[model samples]
Target: MEPLPAAVTAILLDIEGTTTPITFVKDILFPYIQDNVEEYLQKHWHEEECQDDVRQLKLQAEKDSGQKGFVPIPSNTEAELQVIKGVAANVLWQMSLDRKTTALKQLQGHMWRSAYASGKVKGEVYDDVVPALKKWKGAGMKLYIFSSGSVEAQKLLFGYSIEGDLLELFHGHFDTTVGSKVESDSYRRIADKIGCSTENILFLTDIIKEAEAAREAGVHVAIAVRPGNAALTDEEKSEYHLITSFDQLPLQSTH
Candidate 1:
């Protein structure tokens, strides 16, 4: 694939694996959530949004397991039930399985917000991210973010970055609300929001499924493999434009 042109009006980027390292989320963010889930739910139970999500989780759990009510896990005790309000905690724990659950991610943001404000955590961005973002923005490309992470957490991550408030670089944010990044529909939704043809938008991510989805939607795609991360397979290597460094790409405007 050719390098992006200055004429490409919008730039859509992935968060966790592209602009940020996968390790940071896997090692730092998920663990933080696991450690704090019980406490966060207890403290925030009174809030309407929290209560609503908890209710939804209960319903979702029933739907997922085809059970009439909250199915007791191996460790469902009165104390554990109290932590998540009976059925909700089990649902929350189940959400942690592949780390794909929206409820888990939402709960995680609540925890991380506290962590960031208390100076216990800061967001990590790739070394290439800031400079490349600055260069693109300076050249008049409209930048946007799409991640599985909730928009609130996305803001928190960028707002509390080691470089401080890199949120200025993005004009918009999106999460699974539109659709999962692995779905072609997500790219189509994002394209509509950005007021650009999919072909005119460039989507960067480290996950092949997401890149494949974007490519299927007619967007340009690049696979980012960060340092100390698992390498893409031979099939993936054959299928996508793979890069270890942002600098390796022809980033400058060719137009």
Candidate 2:
């Protein structure tokens, strides 16, 4: 791997396939959301937060449906059960498509809180992650996470992590609300938020498009190649520095 820029003062990391295995998200988290959505919605539908999420879901469904325009699911007592069922189906479909809608992420985070609290779910990080994070922090580098998951979800994952409460290590968290990960402007915004020059932040991810976008925005970037991650194309391999482990990161002492 190429040397990280000496000017780098902050490290922005992607969760899935970078610090955490991709299968944990696809196999464990997604399936948990799918299985629990209906029950959660049914139990919480009358609450204000649940209603708000349903409204947002309806809006996204309309956008997804295009010119046809989405029909509102009736919410009256006689029809509310069917409405919940229909909305649950839409949520599942969105999950299947891996849509990064804010409302969907919020709802997922809400569900995950219960799961994590009840001991049904715990976040997983690669063996090297905690030590690497500690080393970077000790060297005075700020750490942040930029993931498609909601900021709340990001905190929950690290807070309930298998490594035990890694949340304190992170300086900040960002999600799609900031912008899509593949957009150059998002990296620029993150750089601004962190009060660092674009050139002084290093972005790490498993996706080639995200690495390209961050690099385009003037942030140094590296592609993580982890087990269970998609194989990189020859072109991608040629384009970005690839690190198979966090221990390979070229973090230098700031002092």
Candidate 3:
């Protein structure tokens, strides 16, 4: 848990199960989408943005038609009630399978935007996250986020967090649009986007696959060990640096 060497000039973080509690996503955010999606659709169905959301979801559903247990959204020609029901059912089905398709995330992002702005939901973060962010930023290191969630969804969490707006803490955010988290090329792409070499980055994530991917990209890594995250095996515990709090991960000292 010593200060990371000066060679690592940037830190890339994961959101759920890393900087934020897994329960926040599992018990709150996901449920918020489930409980309110139908009402949201009913309220906004006439709007162009909602229509775009529905179009994207229908496209996704078409591709998923052959998948087992897939739920299909009816065409607009169907009865309005039937189409609404089909869209809601499709959303629930994708969510139940924990799918991370961009279509699903786009709708969820838009919905969470409404929920967060209305004060119906607030983002959660560990108490130690902000202080450590400050320490690192003060030390002249860049910060960024890389999560499976969409960039808009990532912003909503930090922008409306319980700790208050933390959007300023990051230089940029990356989602699966860059590439899958388990692929080494995504880390390379992220490093390129941040204008740094992969060797200059340190990635923090709870998943070993992501840690391995980052390492393969020549980025340093520290696996975050947080509550509600899957337990790392004994060998993994010894193989990767494990951190329970951001406080344990000091960067190059400013002084």
Candidate numbers, best lDDT first, in rank order: 3, 2, 1
Q: TM per model?
A: 0.80, 0.86, 0.92
Best by TM-score: 3
Which is better, 1 or 2, measured by lDDT? Answer: 2
**Candidate 2 CA-lDDT value:** 0.87
What does the lDDT read for residue 60 in candidate 1?
54
Pitting candidate 1 against candidate 2, the one with the higher TM-score is 2
Count of backbone clashes, every candidate in sequence: 0, 0, 0
Question: 56-99 in candidate 1: lDDT tens per residue?
Answer: 55555655675334344322334644647554457445645554
Local distance difference test, per candidate? 0.76, 0.87, 0.91
In model 3, the runs with Cα more than 4 Å from the true position are none
Q: Model 1 TM-score?
A: 0.80
Ten contiguous residues minimizing lDDT sum, candidate 2 = 67-76
Position 79, candidate 1: lDDT: 62
